[model samples]
Target: MNKTERLLAIVMELQRSKLQTADELAEVLGVSVRTIYRDMMALSEAGVPIIGETGLGYSLMEGYFLPPISFTVDEAVSLLLGTEFIEKRFDPTFRKSARSSRRKIEAILSRPIREETDRIQGSIRLLQKDEMVLMMREKVNLGIIREAMTEDKKLRFTYHKRVAEADGNRVTVRTVSPYGLAHDEQNGWLLLASCDLREDIRHFRVSRMSDLTVTEDTFQTPDNFDLQAYRPKDTRSTQVCAIFNPEIADKVEEANSYYMETAESKEDGYHVTFRVREPEELLSWILGWGADVVVTEPESFINRVREEIGKMKEHY
Candidate 1:
């Protein structure tokens, strides 16, 4: 590797341990003691807080970590997976940021580190499907919302919502914020905010938002705001039990991969269970599957499905 790359690797390796001897680092880098000393001097001159003694080798200063080398294997995997997912789903601005972040990470790794990263990349793969793509998009949107939440800023957007009285026309809304974003699997992306005018915790769908702008006006997130408590308590909050044909079990499994429950296989098919705070979302999903899936429980959910199907048939 080049000198800059080698120096970064040394700093990262040193940060991983308490104190490493010069000989150990030299051996790991395939270099001699004198070369190691020269490199150490170069790193120190470059403002790396490397501490050492005559007998001991070196250690990075506490609280001073190499940004690129600091991530654990799990963190690295999450970053890579999240970045790839965003690149596939988001608009140009977010896609560029994700690509840039990945490049910055790759530039900081040594040959060995790069190899380890490659292994992680090979171990996990996002099987691209329509639902997976949508999930990825939601993840990306959630990330943006989370960032805005952390900054405690207002977001301005033109929101589109269904207007049942007006032949399904979408109404536009301009909203501000009091807090961050929360993911409602049943509702897609939701921003928990006090509307600019209402000053109440209203949920706005991320997909319905356009021309989003994070404002400089900061607001305090209410300490009492709890997403779990705010959830709908009607039968809509009930758990859904479904069975999928074995032939399409894998696809079905991928669809609900983010849920808190597990899927088990039976002689007939695969049984999956999950909770939804809104039945409309689940109903839409089940209808999308046509006949490959069956809703096995929650009589209310079945009735809702029947009602929705009747509405659709009337329209046809």
Candidate 2:
């Protein structure tokens, strides 16, 4: 960091914490002790109210604070766009706060910067399905899940599975400790929680949740659990290979099936490999392709496809 930036950061660090030792400051700021000493001298010479004890540490005097930091046009634009995204993607509770924050940020910008920020922000569009327009049940579940996570409480809900059993039963009740929430383009909102019934961490799509309620019971989150880095293990190991007609190869790739591991185009056709929990998971997808795709490996899977085709022929 530049000297000016480092000076500002030192002031910020002091304001954030109490009695920061030179060693602690050096380690946190990634500078040497000698550099920290020099910086301390520089800060004191600049008339900053920093009190340093020989044995203890350094601290800013009570009631001392830095003035409001100014933002560049680019910074203002970035923050305004972030607030816009939050306003669209979050529930009503946070959407209102985002609007307020956007106004406050715009209010502080200078006339030229504000005009430039508005021009830039107007040119950029963050297009996505608004979360507020989602199903009422899903929106309610999202709010309850957020509150449960904030209060460190448990949540009880009925979840509808994506896949149904032979008996057509797809509903199950679950009580989970809401750990965190995530969103993706495909899935609107996913709740990562520790499931009581499954006795493990599980992801529940908010859209599939029904009758969600927060419980009064509170619990502490485990230190080892990191929401940002969490990914569910893919246990699908069965490899199924296929070849699609070159005419529809691009279309096949566009499908972007979760289990598609590899796709290669050769002289004859487009070779594709899929690893799935079970071969049956790809049965419908394969049938949808009709004669455009052919299975090339796992003789049993080919036979299963033949059997399905025979049944389909009989129906015809």
Best by TM-score: 2
TM-score of 1: 0.47
Overall local distance difference test of candidate 2: 0.84
**Alpha-carbon local distance difference test for all models:** 0.70, 0.84
Best by lDDT: 2
lDDT of 1 at 150: 76
Task: Give the 10-residue window scoring lowest on summed lDDT in candidate 2.
Answer: 130-139
RMSD of each: 10.8, 14.7
lDDT of 2 by residue, 130-223 (tens): 4455636455677788899889999999999766544666899999999998987667788899999889999888988888889988878899
The sequence of per-residue lDDT tens digits that candidate 1 reaches over residues 166-192 is 245466556577465555545655777
TM-scores of the models, in the order given: 0.47, 0.66
Off by over 4 Å in 1: 1-98, 126-153, 161-174, 182-190, 196-199, 211-218, 223-281, 289-316
